[model samples]
Target: MSEVYGWEFSDGPGDHFAVTADHLFAGIWSRPELDLRERRLLLIGALTAQGQFDVAEIQLGAALRNGEFTADQLREMALFLCHYVGWPAGTALDGVVGKVVDQQRKSEQANKTK
Candidate 1:
């Protein structure tokens, strides 16, 4: 996991929670019909539909970091959601997505400078 993300899963309650969550997550991810990208899109849609923008933002950030999608792709998804799910949810996400994507872009630029 550290190979994909710069951080490692810490030990203790958080680790236990992560392990359980990953087990459940892996069941869906392991399905032959859905590749990682497809699963990510499904998760994105579900999160949006359920009004779980915070968790959706986290998943979007991870997906961006992992090169699963581009910033443009995320923006497009948000726009689509605005159309289908209503403007309120998409409006609510504006700051969240902006902050995350801005931070990620800065991080990427800093890494390049190093």
Candidate 2:
């Protein structure tokens, strides 16, 4: 949660939602089938299909951080996804991927400076 949002959450207000989400994420992530990269790709596909660019943005950034996919690869994947998700959603996905790629590069540069 903190990694996704770039902030720590207090176990005070709205704690139930966060706690529930934590448990759900843990359960899903702990399951022995697909690796994180595979799961992330599936999630990106679902989110993009639904036009959920905001959440997809988070996933994209995490993918870059985790070295799951390169920007070029993601862009290529988005192009391939266009046929299945339709051009509109696929275009949106491409835009978010570009945004995340820039953000990741900036973050890496900042970390190096520090």
What lDDT does each candidate get? 0.75, 0.84
lDDT of 1 by residue, 1-91 (tens): 3423335655447677778647655565666896777878888877887899888888788888888888888887888888877888766
Tens-digit lDDT string for candidate 2 (2-110): 5434456555567787778678566776577987788889989999999899999988888888788899999987898899999999998999999999998998999
User: Mind sharing the TM-score for model 2?
Assistant: 0.84
Displacement of the residue 58 alpha carbon in candidate 2, Å = 0.5
Best candidate, lDDT-wise? 2
CA shift of 56, model 1, Å: 1.1
RMSD of 2: 2.5
- Positional deviation of residue 30's Cα in model 2 after best superposition, in angstroms: 1.2
Q: Whose TM-score is greatest here?
A: 2
Deviating ranges (above 4 Å) for candidate 2: 1-15
- Which residue ranges in model 1 land beyond 4 Å of their true spot? 1-7, 10-19
